[model samples]
Target: MDNPSLFEQLGGERELRTIIDEFVDRVFDDVMIGFFFQRASRERLKAKEYEFAAEHLGGPVTYSGRPIAQAHAAHPIMGGQFMRRLRILEEVLEAHDVSPAVREHWLAHTEGLRAMVTRDSGGRCDPVDAMKRVQERGKE
Candidate 1:
């Protein structure tokens, strides 16, 4: 048999959705990254996340969202926030019993996407505080 795609290795669409559901839930509860997701519709977000993951993992789905950088540019996401979210992902994958090789492959792909996801070079500034500072700077 031909080698399985990463999407298949990770259990295809249904299983991936389960993982993303829990992953997004964990993210919503996290203080550092939760600030950025306060208004997210979990249902909608799950679909979009699955599509993005499917496309990246060589699945059959096409990702129809905006470009990654354009999508994240609205947020002042620090490098630290990105790392925190990634750790949450690792935890979720571990909980789901995904294999180590698959997890590492997934992590490497995601880590490579950091530049596109993070607009802030600053590490760990509270996004709300960062925005306030920008407004304060403009007032001066």
Candidate 2:
């Protein structure tokens, strides 16, 4: 059995970048979250996503700017919003035909960041509820 780290399972930076790109594209189309990205460009967001993935996957830290928590501190996203983003992210992964093992691996790795991200988003979100939604989704 191949017990690869989530980073290895994801095929390293290139594959992670691809996944983030695809996921962000879907986010751009989501009416609820799209507005949040109105002032951002795909390229910039892509770079940010890449940095985030790299950091979480135990790779070199490419994100050297302000911490995510401070950056999104004013965004009023709550548990429901986080759930919505997760749903969209999952949909993108599925649509892109990402392998189930790889998808699950990455999701598991990234799941821990929910509280950090939401809290940084100004505590507008309920971490407990966000965790519940993540658990519920995992059951599907």
Highest TM-score: which candidate? 1
Overlapping backbone residue pairs in candidate 2 total 1
For every model in order, what is the number of clashing pairs? Answer: 0, 1
Q: Predict model 1's lDDT versus the native.
A: 0.84
lDDT of 2 at 110: 54
TM-score of each: 0.82, 0.69
> CA lDDT of each candidate?
0.84, 0.72
Those runs of model 2 whose alpha carbons end farther than 4 Å from true positions after fitting are 1-4, 97-102, 119-140
